[model samples]
Target: MNKRKYEMTSRADAAARTADRIIDAMLARFATTPYENVRIEDVAADAGVTGQTLIRRFGSKAALMNATVARELARVAAAREEAAQASPTDTIHELIHHYERYGALILKTYSEAPLVAGLPALAARGRAFHVDWCRRAFPLDPSLSPTEKAVRTAQIIAICDATTWRILRFDGELDEAQTEQALAALLLPLLV
Candidate 1:
C-alpha cells in the first residue's frame, strides 16, 4: 500500500511557521546576547530545530539577520505611520512606547555594529528612518534659511534619538508618563 503525500499548501504553511519560529527565536536571543555571540546551534535549539534546519530555512547568519531586520523595520514603520497621524504629543508618547519596548536592543546593535559586517549600513537605514519620521512628525520653521532648517532638523533628530530615550528612561529612571512629559517639554517647544 502507498502512503498519502502531504499537501503542497500545507507544507508551505509549515515552512512559513518554522521560519517564523526561527525569527522569533533569533530576536529573543538578540534581546540579551550580542550579535557576534549568537550561535546557530543555540538559536536552532531555541526554535526546536537543528542548525542544519536553520541554514536550510535562512541560508546563512547574515541572511537570517537581514530577514529579521526586514521584519522589524516593517513593524516599526507601521507603528510610526499610525503615530504620524496623531498629534505631536501623542506621537512622542508613541515613540516613547516604542523606545521602551526596543530601545535596549537598538543600543545593543549599535554598540556591536563595528564587529559585524553590514551593521553600519543597517544602522544607517535605521537612522534614515528616524530622520524621515522626525521630519514628518516635526516640520521645520519655513521662515528659516536652508542652513538653519538643516540645523533644526538635526536638532529634532537628536532629541528624538534612542540615546535620548535611554538617558530619560534608563539613566534618569523616569516612568513612562514622566518620560513622555520630559520629551514633550523639550520637543513640543520646537513644534511651535
Candidate 2:
C-alpha cells in the first residue's frame, strides 16, 4: 500500500507539472497573439504535450485561458507587493522591469477586452490592481481630503502606467535609464 501511494503521488506531481507547462505556454501565446488567435494546438506543441492532453486537462480553450490569466495575475500581484516595499528609485526600477516583461500582455488584453468574452472583467481587474498598486506605492496623507487624494492617485497612475513607458521607451526611443528617469521625474514630484 505504501508503494502504491508513492507511485500515485508521483503521477499526480507529474500531472500538475504538465498542467503548469501548458498554462505557461498559453501565457506566452497570449502575450504575443490576440486572444482569439491563440491556437490550442500551438500551445500544446509549445508545452511538449498532445492537444488531446491539453483538452483533457483544461476541458476547453476558455478554461485554459482562464487558468493562464489566474496564474499571471497572481504573479503580478506578488511582484507588485515586492515593488511597493522597495525605495522610490528601486520601485521605479522594479516597475520598469515589470513593464518590460508584461506590458505587451496587459496592453494586448486591454485592446481586445471590448471584443472578447470574459475579457472586460479581466481588464477591469487589471485596472483595479494597478489602482491598488499605485495607492500602495505612492500613499497620500490621510489628512488630505478625498478629492485631493483622488487627483493625486490619478496622476501617479498616469505617470507610471505601461502606456507612458511605451511612449518613452518605444516611440521616443529612450533607453531603459532614460525611461526610468522620465518616470521618476513625473512620479516623484507628485509623491512629494
Q: lDDT of each model, Cα atoms only?
A: 0.86, 0.87
lDDT of 1 by residue, 1-192 (tens): 233355766788899999999999988998888788899899999999999999998888777876776688778888988998899988998999999888888887778767766667877788789899999988867998899888778888998999999999889999989988999998887776
Q: What is the lDDT of residue 169 in candidate 1?
A: 88
Q: Against the true structure, whose lDDT is highest?
A: 2
The true-versus-predicted C-alpha distance at residue 47 of model 2, in Å, is 1.2
Which RMSD values do the candidates have, in order?
Answer: 3.2, 1.8
Estimate the TM-score of every prediction. Answer: 0.91, 0.91
Candidate 2 lDDT score relative to the true structure:
0.87
Q: Give per-residue CA lDDT, model 2, range 1-192, as digits (tens).
A: 699999999999999999999999998888878878988999999999999999999988887887777788889989989999988889999999998988778777678777655757877888899988988988877888899889988999998888999999999899888999999998887776
Give the clashing residue pairs of candidate 1, or none: none
Clashes of each: 0, 0
